[model samples]
Target chain A: MKYTIFPGCLISYRFPEYEKSAKLILQKLEVEFIPVDSFSCCGSQVLESIDDEKMVLLNARNLAIAQELDIGSIITLCGSCTHILKKSLIKLHDNKILKRINKKLRLIGLKFFPKKKIEIIHIAEFLNKKEIFQKFQNLVVKKLEINIAVQNPCMVLRPSSISNLELKDRKIIRNLLTSTGITASSYRYMNRCCGGTMLAFDDSIAKDLGKLRYKELQKSGANILAVGCPNCQLMYSIYQNMLVDDVVPSIFFTQLLGLSIGFSQKDMEIDKNINTEIISNILNNSIKNNG
Target chain B: MNECKECGACTNACPLNEYDENYIVYKIFFGPEKDFKLWTRCCSCFLCEENCPYGLNPREEIFKIRRNSDRSNIPPRIIKYYENIKRTGFVFNIDEYVNEERIEYGLVKLNLDRIKSEVNKLFNI
Candidate 1:
C-alpha cells in the first residue's frame, strides 16, 4: 500500500521526536512511505466546531494532494488528526459535498476525486497490521525491563462510525506493546480521555481529569506510560509533570518500540520528555547490562 | 418521543460524571432539547456511546447540540484557536525556532505560504 505522512501540526511543533522515530521505524520495517509537503492541518475538533465547510476544505486539500501523488493512505501520529481527516474522507464521498469543496479547490489548482480512494490510518494501528508486525518483530534487539500502561487514543477507536473499529481492532496499541516482551499493566480508566483536548478550553477541568488518570496509572504499578497521540504526550509528559508530584513518565509507543528495535535513546529523543530522567537511567542501566 | 431507558450505564462509565454527579449528560443527550436539563460538560471522549447497551450514540447527539447552539455558549479560548487556524492554517504558530527544531530532528520544513492564501480564500466564505 502506498502511504504518505500527514504531519499534523502538534507533532511538528511539540513532538518532532514522534515523527523522527516513526520514520526511522518505518524505514527499518522496509515500508515505503512518501513525504508530502504543503499539507495543512486536519482541521481537528476545534475547526469542526467553528465551520464544517472550511474544515472539510482544508482536509480536502490535503486529501487531494494524496490523490494527485497517487498515494493510497495518509498515516498520522495524532488521534485528532486521524479522526478529522477520516471524517472528511467520508464526507467528501458525498457527491454534493465533493462538488462544493471542489469549487474552492479549483482556485488552488487541486481537486479531490472521491472515486479514487484514499485512507487515513494512525501509526499505532498501522504498525499492528499483521505483515508490518511480523517485519517489526524481527527488528527487536532489546527487551528493556519495565512495566508500561498503554493509553490508546480514544479518538482513534470511538464514535465507531468514523473510526470503524471492532472490539479486536481497539486492542491494537496494547497488543503492539505486549509483542515487544515488556510488562503491560492494566490501568483503570485506561480507555478514558487524557483531557488534552479539553485542556484547550477548560484548564481546571482538564487538570481534574489528569489528576484522576495519573492516580489510576500510578496505582496500577506501571513504571511508564505509552501513548499514540501527541495530545496525550504533551498532557502526560508536560502537564502531568507540573500538576502532579508523583509522575509515571510518558513516551510515544514509537519511542518504546524504537528501543526494542535497537535504536538508541537519543534516536528516540527521550530527553525532550520532562520527568523522564528516571526512564533515561533505566535505559542506561539496561544498555550497560547488555554491553 | 425518545428511546432512552435512562439505564445510567453511560453516566456511570463517564469519567467526567465521576466528579460531578449531576452531570448526567447522557440522559440529557438522549432526550429532546425541551427534555434536556441544561446540559454541561463534554470532553468528547465518546465513552457514553461506547458504554450504551442498546447501541445508542449519545455523544453524537450531544455534539449535534453543541454545533447548533448559540455562539455565546462557545468559550472565547476556543474561538481564539479557531482564529489561529484561519490566520495561519495551523493551530499554533510555527515560527523560526520551530522550523529550526524540525531541521534538527531531521524532518522537512513546512511551506504554508501557498496553503495559507488558499485557506484564506476558503475562510472568506
Candidate 2:
C-alpha cells in the first residue's frame, strides 16, 4: 500500500492546487507515500521526438529511483507522465534496452530491476481501484447534486495496451467522479482530444480545438466540467475565460472530491482557480442537500 | 488507400480535422505528402492510433517524419522547449520564486541540483 507522488512537470510548475488536492485526499485515506523530488522529467513529448532513446533512458532513471525508494505504486497527476513512465517501463523489459539503460543508470548510482515491479498509475486510475473507491465513497460526508460532464485523459486510458485500462475500465475518470454522488452525465466530446500536445508546436490549433470543444461544452448543460488531466485543465480551466462567453469552470475531480469528503472551500484552494467566483456560487447551492 | 483502409475513422475521430478540412489524418499515413508543417498540427492524443481499424499508428509515423525532417521545417518553440529540457530536466525553468510559491501552497519545493547531473548524463546536455 506504499505510494509515491509523481508530480509531473506541468502540475509542479503551474498547477500546485491539483497536487495539493490529491495529497490531501491520499493523506485522509491514510495512505503513506515518500515525497521523492530527486526524479527529473518524465521526458514528456519534447524528448520523445528529439531522441526517443533519451526519453526512455531518462524515464528509466525515474523508474530506477522509484524501485530504489521501494515505492510500490507511483501516482501521477498528469496523463502524459503516466503514459511516458508506463511506456518506458514496458520498453525497458527488453533485455538489450535494459542493459543499455543500466549502463547509463550506473553512472548515476542506480539500476533498473524489472522484478521490483513499480506500478505507474494516474491519480484517476488509482482512485478508481475498487478497494480505494469504496474507501473514498465511505468518506463522502456530503453529496453535491451538481450535474458534471467529465473530460477523460487521452494518455491515461488509451491504446488499451500502454495504459493497461480494459474496455470496461475505460470510464475510470468518469467512474471516479461519479462516486461523489454528483450527477454524472456523458457529453458529445467527453473523450475527445483537447489538443494540449499541439501546444508545443502550434498553439493556435490547440486553442482552436479548445474553443470548438468549449462551445459544445457550453451546450452540454452539465453546469460544470470535471477534468482529470492537467492539459485539459489548461484548456478548459486556465483558458476558459478567453475561450468562451459562458464558461463552465472546468475543475479537477479531486478538488470536487475533497469537498464531498467534508473539506471546506479553503481546503480545496478554491480561490486559486480562475472561475472561483462561479464555483463558489455553485458550492453555495450544492450544500443545501447536505443538511 | 494502400493500407489506411481510408475508413475515415481516424479523420472523423480527430479533433483538429473538424476545424481544418485539409487535415485528413489517413492521407498523411497514406503518404507521399511532403508538408512537415501539416505533421506539426497533431496533438498526439493517440485518438487516431486507437481509432484506426487496422491499428496502424499515424501519430508515430508523423513523429518519425518530424524527427527526420529538416530542422528548419519544424517550429521554433518546440525546438526551444527541447533544448530547455536538455539543459534543465524540467520543461519550464525552475527558480527560487517557483519553489517558494509551491511551499506557500503547501506543496514540496523542487531541488533540481540533485538530478541535474543524472539528467545531464542521460541527455548529454
Candidate 3:
C-alpha cells in the first residue's frame, strides 16, 4: 500500500498540517508514501482556462515520474489538484489531440508512455477503505462525540469515473466517522463547489458564494464543518466567522481526526487555524468528553 | 402559440438571481435587447436549464454572453494568463520555478530550443 504523494502548492505552504497529519495517519495505517521530490505544481484552475496542451504535458510528466518509480497510485490532498490530474490523465489516455502533445514531450527527453494506470486517489479515498477505517478506529485515543457537518467540494467527486460512485464516497466517510464514535451528518448543499474557481478572478463573488454555503451549514447547528480539501478548508476558514454572525466555526477533517487520535493541538498546528474560538472549544470538549 | 403562463418558473430557477434579480430568462426570447452582462455571472451549473419547461438552454445563453462580451473589456488578468499559455503551451510559471528538487524527482525539464523546433514542426507555429 504505497503511493506517490502530490501535496500541491497550497498544502506545502498554506496548510502543511494537512500534509503532516495525512502522512502520520497513513503511516499508522501501514500505507507507505514515497514523496516525488521533483514534482511540479498541478496547474489546477489556471490550466483548464489557459493552456490545455501544457496542462496535459505537465500532468503527464508527474505521472511519468510516478511510473518511473514504479508507484501506480498517486494520492493528492487538494480536490482541485485531484480533479485536474485525474481529468488530464483521462484525456491523455483517451484523446488524440493530447497524443500530439505527448510527442512534444519526446523532444524534451521525456517519453510520454500513457499505458501507466496511475490511480489518483484523494486522501479521503485512501482512508475510506474498511481496513484503514478499522485501523483508524483501533488507534483512536479519544472518540469525538460532537456533530460534524461534512463539506464535499464539487471537484473532488465530480467529472471522473468516481462521480458515478459518489454515493459510496459519502457512505465511506460516514462509516469511518461512525466507527470512531463521532456523529456526522450530510447537510444540504453537501456536493457543492467552494467557489475556488472564482476566488482569484472574482474575489467578491467567490466570497459571497462561500458565505452562502457557510450560512447553510451554520443553520444546520453542526458544531464543526469537516472538510477534505485544503482549498475548501482555507476558503471556509477565511470566511467562516464573517459568514455566521454568531455560530460555531469550521475545521479540517484531518485536524479533527488528529485531535481525536491524541495528537496535541500544537503538533497538529491547530492554533494557526483561522477559524474562531468555537472550534477550539469543540476540540476541548472532544478531549474532555473522551477522557 | 402558447399563452404567457407567467408562472415565473424560469426566473425562479435561475442561480444568477442570487447575484442579479434583473436577469430574467424571458429576456432572451422577449426583451427589447439582451442584457449580456446578466449572462456573464452564470457558473454554468445548469440548474436553470434543467428547470425550464420550454426546453430553453440558459447555459447556451451564457455561452453567447461570454462570446459577445466586448473584447476590449475583457479582464486583463485572464487575458494575460491566456496569452502566456498560448506562447509557452503552459499556464504556470514553470520555467521560473523549476528547482533542483523538481529535476531530481524526474520532472522533464523543457529544452526551449528543442521544444520550439518541435512545436514549429508539429503545428507550423
Interface RMSD values, listed in order for every candidate: 1.6, 1.3, 6.3
**Runs of candidate 3 exceeding 4 Å displacement:** A160-164, A242-244, B1-74, B79-125
Among these predictions, the greatest TM-score belongs to 2
Tell me model 1's lDDT, rounded to 2 decimals: 0.82
lDDT of 3 by residue, A1-291 (tens): 458677676665466667766766766667767766556567665555445566677677667667778787888888878877887787787658556766766654555567766688777777775677677778887788789777765566654343444545655445555567788766765665566556545667767777677777877778877777776776677665565575456666777777667778875667767764666777787777766
Between candidates 2 and 3, the one scoring higher on DockQ is 2
* TM-score preference between candidates 1 and 3, better one: 1
Q: What is the TM-score of chain A in candidate 3?
A: 0.90
DockQ, Cα level, model 3 = 0.13
- lDDT, residue B5, model 1: 88
Task: In angstroms, give how far residue A175 of model 1 lies from its true place.
Answer: 1.8
Error of 1 at A44 (Å): 1.4
The sequence of per-residue lDDT tens digits that candidate 1 reaches over residues A1-291 is 787778888888888999999988987887777877678788777877667778888999889988998999788999889988988888898999999999989988999998897888998888987888898888898887777898888899887878878877877887887888877899876678787887776777878888888888889898889899998987798889888888999989899899999898889999888756888986777678766
Q: How many steric overlaps are in each model, in order? A: 0, 0, 2
Q: lDDT of all the models against the reference?
A: 0.82, 0.82, 0.63
